[model samples]
Target: MPIITVTNHVGPTYALEPRAPTAASATLFRNFIQWNVVNAVDGYVVQHIQRNEKYWVQRHFPRHQTYQAVSVDDYWECWRVTVAAGVTTITPARDLINDKFTVVTVMDAPGADGTVGRFPDKTGTRGRWKLRGLVYFVADPGLVIADWPAGGAPSAGLLHSRLLPPIQGNGLARNRQGRLGGVLFRREFAGSWDWTTEDQRIAPRADDGVGAPPLVTYRDPVVSARNFPALAGFRSRNIRTADEAAGGWLPIARRPAHG
Candidate 1:
């Protein structure tokens, strides 16, 4: 079974109020920020994966195969969040954790038709092959921002954006047509944040700008392995025979009984 791994490279840059008493305190505060950022990004990525799975099952998989139910084992797929090594310093203005980094999310869905098994069932002697598709979303830079409170943790709403709707039509339809289908991939800061009062407050925006109020942003564009040049390669893979697809299933062993 092929594992679906989505790697997200979030802010190597983070913004926080410079109010910690000790260096350890500052590191702890930064860790809190890192945890929240990782959670928010992970939530978005999971939603996208679920949306893609639903679309694929409906459009690509055979009619008999239903959407695979998620199990506990599936949750074991490792989710590793690492912060880049950087010096934590306070300079009367604000503290920043500025090290470019990536977070990886792995989804292992064994026995799932669209994710693990062959797409179309073999017909008579005809061979079948397992196929998968990927797509990328490059959100506009400097769109995601977070407002941290001076005395308390930031509100979850401050980091979350509106859920992105699933792309409609057949499998890989958007990629095939070379468009986003009008679905915007950005944080809902305008709708989610209180701009009237919080606009002037200290906040971090996702970007590489320096000397400006610190912000957290995804420096890399969201990309799928099955897009453009790679899309052609994905579509032209050689087919596998039924014997090869059977994998390691063995016949049931039985003991003969005396009459």
Candidate 2:
């Protein structure tokens, strides 16, 4: 699965890096979240954070086991842990604990660092990552509108490499959820492909940034919303924050986000 990493920049001093779960992986986990949010607020609000959290997870480190409890570790995985008494580690150490979940400690780990704890059983070659980071956001009650997914273990501060520079303006050019801005989300593959080989990988001949169609073209399978129960009763107007950038909202017409 291709990973799409995104970052929320705040000034030059802080940022938020969420975990990146592939659209495919998200489809798999949608049911789990929907089941949990069934009795919560309108299912729309429930779906909002569920999808957003997937984006948040890709760029940040896994939340540790505070005292010892089962948690939804990443988009596609859940974890159960038992912390040693008095350990009081702010975060879990990024090591396997009792053949169960991996622990990450805040002192030595931060950002979106550990893959072992990112997703369940991610010890495979396709999942190895070295560093991680995080940022926090409090969604505006009014902007509780709408949602969005993926991928690789990127280094700290580099999560925005694929993003175009943010448009400079005054206070909140877009609404509380960043609705009016043009934020491009991209997917990058490094080294060898995880699910397919370099030769077999498809790349459709699309116009390059230069304007000419590229020579290589590949096919990317579409992730259907039918697979996600969280989206069962979702509506677009309920989550939309503004009127501009409607193209960006196609996927929204298509996803929630967490705060």
Candidate 3:
């Protein structure tokens, strides 16, 4: 998510401070410089990120030898990858966790003489620097309860869900209303239990004006569970460890239909 965010910033700084007489020329030169620089950035930046990561992990895997694995309970927030990687759940888009992601790459330009340049910008070297895949993620600071697994299947459809009641497009859910205070539950009393938990939207004022706001999904989390015909699943960027690729993955077996 952070990688491409850099595209917003690219331009010439002080080329020896633009001279008064050459203002037009300077501006033209700087504009040309900016266009070329950004285009150069985009050419390699766009196409290369997706493939590099797959190649790295699956082909020539790198091991974090010194990296010590920690228990989920002891690990930091970002370090927590859900043990439920394979245990798929069908939660609402917003309910799923691990929402943000980014791609980064390092380009290696090959020189005319077939030599690869180690550094491009600083050396002003002309070599062929190709783009490679770089995967990055952004932890949603707004996630209220995120114990979801890492590399969780990406969310399909409109992955970004909002907590707010429908203000535009679809109307608010029947049970949802102003400033969602909290979800209500019913309590049983007799043979025919009370309908107390029938679902109601209570405002903060309803609880003596001091209860915390009810947490809602600010954005949809990635999900992986469904054979929906019309709708499609999230596009996965598959990567595998070399060891796991020994025999290659087996195809998912299909089941027979029942009447």
Using TM-score as the measure, the top candidate is 1
Residue range 1-259, candidate 1, lDDT tens digits: 1112222334222222233453221110111111123212211111121111111111111322222211110110001122234322211111332111111111222222222332221111111111221222322221221211121111111222222222323112333432223322221100000101222234445463433432222222222221122222222112222222222111112111112
As a TM-score, model 2 comes out at 0.15
Better of 1 and 3 by TM-score: 1
My TM-score estimates for the predictions, one after another, are 0.18, 0.15, 0.13
Candidate 1, poorest ten consecutive residues by summed lDDT: 187-196
Candidate 2's C-alpha runs over 4 A off are: 1-128, 142-145, 149-259
lDDT score for residue 76 of model 3? 13
User: Candidate 3: lDDT over CA atoms?
Assistant: 0.19
Tens digits of per-residue lDDT, candidate 3, 99-151, equal: 22211112222222323322111111111111122222222231222222331
How many collisions between residues are there in candidate 2? 46
The CA-based lDDT of model 2 is what? 0.19
User: How would you order the candidates by lDDT, starting with the best?
Assistant: 1, 3, 2
